[model samples]
Target chain A: MSYGPTPWVQRHWDLRAAANFAAGGAGSGLIVVAALSGARDAPAAVALLAGLALVAVGLFAVWLEIGRPLRALNVFFNPRTSWMSREAIAAVVLGVFVLRAAWLHATDSPGAVATGAAAALAALVFVGCQGMILRAAKGIPAWRSSATPWLIVATSLAEGAGLWWIAAAAHAQGTRTGLALFGALLCVRLFAWLAWRRSIARNARASAAMAPAGTALSVLGTALPLVLAGVAAISTSPAVVLGLAGTAGALAFGTGIAFKIALVVRGAFNQGFAIPHMPVRGKRA
Target chain B: MTRWAMVADLRRCVGCQTCTAACKHANATPPGVQWRRVLDIEIGNFPDVKRAFVPVGCQHCEDPPCMTVCPTKATKKRADGIVTIDYDLCIGCAYCAVACPYQARYKTERATFAYGKAAAHEAKRHDPDRLAVATKCTFCVDRIDAGLAAGQQPGVDPEATPACVNACIAQALTFGDLDDPSSNVSKLLEMNEHFRMHEELRTGPGFYYLWDRSEETGGVPALKRLVEEAMDLA
Candidate 1:
């Protein structure tokens, strides 16, 4: 009565939510690479600092999205029941490792691997929890598919790999290998997305919601990035390789944000009322 | 073990929307927000078309997805089967609204009036605390609780019944403890050809609709035979 005769969606989460996903993706992505890259010098500092900064920005973005930003801490009250609360906890743990990694980088510590690995694991949880957040929304069938987590994981990894490649390129470190991993992760995302779309297509409403977004994910989000990476892969010239790889990284990051925007904004539709039998003149609907 | 439920007899309902009006008056919901509504559904091709009135609202589901998804644990189901939202605890994230298949939940941050300005009656019934939070049909929890404290039985006493049920002019709506076989709702459900919406979801909704008395209402013999095992277990 309030919204629709058919199901309706709550238009609460908007661009701020998209920002949350993008910033969180970039942050977690940076930490993931920083943790695994085994970078003991200048590039490690760049990754650690940027990663922590983006995570903070992402947290703030979500905090701003809530009606009562001051009441944000109250979300911690239901960790046992809510993925959102768990995301907050994971964010805190990731922050701790992030700080330690930054300190290790600044202090020129040789045992940076432990701190980096801790940060990376925490980063994975932080990003994967966002997927869990979507999976927990049982109302939107499109978000609840089993493939959602894998897709998010793949997206996060690709975004992180892309950032590492960019940072490495900027620091004159070899960028080709990191670009390869980023490309591979994007491929993982493309496959997982296809699986997700197939699984959710069984539901009529979910299929309707996924149609446009799934197409965008397949064509603009997946194919465009991969094709660019292939061009970068084949190029023997230094400038050509760097520029193409940079463009590929940029596309991969944009795709991550676009996919989430489609999900958090467009793909959210409520399941409407249903009746087993349609009512007729002298009958019940 | 009080499980409150509602049973609507389609034959008796006139689709006058008195229940919808009564709920709005009782709840003082802001403009565009309704706690109860009667859906007029028409079916069949032109010449053979038929229409029916369906009272749709929160089912007070046994396994409410809204409750499961609330990040602040603001949405909860009572032991007595009334689903409610703790407004103070809710962050107005609208997660519960999206999770509810029934679309019974609503979130409104802005204050709106029916006819430009808030009328005296609306102003009287308005709940300021309800703003910026997920709100829905509580089955008139306040009335039930107050009546219980005053030694009145819910669904039995007029003062305790939901505003919608009490205002049904045709007596189409019955309210009672579903767990009590002697109760009006339970008795109505047992005697009539009744069904709950989205039963396949296994949410065990408290609202039941008595559609028709037709012998064919049960559908084919094969269908009956297929359900016989489950019915036998029940």
Candidate 2:
């Protein structure tokens, strides 16, 4: 019952917050990556639509996490001091740009590239704000470090590339670029995750729970995904390349979701209350 | 320049948990929720072991991480160094709950009683709407404000003081204006050897612990000081 000095958190943020953050990061990354790649055709469009839908669902999940869902609008009222508010504003900007891009493409208009670029920027901002939300919470020593935001953004980049690769895997015409991008993003994710784990391990107050997630992320998330994507990018065999790309996509997305759950859930152990003195066994004075 | 603070004398505490009960009764906290609690930890090896009682709730820190990360501006610190959560403004986002380094905040979705469903006492005590929001020790702000308005002195008047301070059976807890050197808490801090919880975090907690006079001042050697110093390095 006693937390000693390091209180084990009783799950302040349940599965809902984790799901929302994962979806928001992966979905936003998907939109940005899909746009930058030359897959502006049917598959990329599908991924964009799905990504936007996931983001919308993600926002709804946050609404469900609160006590009064009606008061959720107040979350966006304070952008000056609150990263959560800034995230809402960025979400709004992203929604508008993404919708505009979709409309232009639907109407066969010429301004989709411009709209896509804007949407990508907004999505990146939203994802960054989400990471800053965790970084801003100083109570969780594992999350308060400077590397948390970078790790989150890096994971999002890999997840987005994985998602885009999944959508465009059927057509080998534009798969190499997405696969190569996926490998690069995996490298970024690995570096950031390693740095994050090192920082957390060095913290005197941080629990040892996340050291395992770091290993997990490096293996299943970065190493396997990169190896599979690298092979797919250079492979001449269509069957082998497509199979490997699918595996890479699965591994990348799984890593993103798993690492986020571990970070937001178990990484949230309280730093514990500290004391300066102890009473002796036999003394009242 | 009114800064409210509490001074807990470790030598006087018997860990009776009277303050814990009094806080729950005064706040009408839910059946499982505790606004203030006394934790008993056994320190040192068995042969030289000693039991220490720590009365903990909120530090009500100078740099309250809860207030900084609050998305709705619902958590705020008043001019008197008391941190409070505005129930009306809080969207029940538990960010404040997690942001608290002391794990002081509590959130309960349902109003339950000790015996069964809502008893008559629970019905009278419970604020049904407070279920979703972040809640912690308010330092009995309502009583302090009402008592001040009525020209009663806080820390001296029972009605004006925090319920936990008033209910302490051992009189181990002292509360007063930290801004005034003449106040009970301030005088105690000046006259005794004291340390704050998590001082290295630079939170500048309003709560202080007066363990004992140091050995250099002709008192017993402070094993507690050695333990605290080693932890600070860790």
* Highest TM-score scorer: 2
Residue-wise lDDT of candidate 1 within A148-255, one digit each (tens)? 887777777777777776665565565556667767777888888888878777677657766776677667666887787788778788777777667666767776
Pairs of colliding residues, candidate 1: A29-A160, A278-A285, A279-A284, A279-A285, A280-B50, A281-B50
How high is the TM-score of chain A in each model? 0.90, 0.92
TM-score of each: 0.90, 0.92
Candidate 1 residue B4 C-alpha distance from true site, Å = 1.0
What are the RMSDs of all candidates, in order?
A: 5.1, 6.0
Q: Summarize candidate 2's per-residue lDDT along A1-285 as a digit string, tens digits.
A: 555554675477888888878999999989888787855645555666777887898888878888767888888767888888899899999889888887776666788778878888898998999899889877787887899999888898788877766665656545676677778889999889878878777564344777667677889888888888777778899888888887788788887888888888767777776676674324434
Per-candidate iRMS values, in order, are 2.4, 2.3
Instruction: List, residue by residue over B1-234, the lDDT tens digit for candidate 2.
Output: 999998888878898999999999999998767888887877679697776788888888998888888889888899999999888888987888777777888888766789878788788877977888889998899999999999987898998999999999889998899999889887677756789887877777898888875434314334565567799999
**Number of backbone collisions per candidate:** 6, 2
lDDT on C-alpha atoms for all candidate structures: 0.78, 0.81
Rate residue B140 of model 1 by lDDT. Answer: 93
After superposing candidate 1 on the true structure, give the runs of residues whose Cα lies further than 4 Å from its correct spot.
A169-171, A203-209, A279-285, B214-234
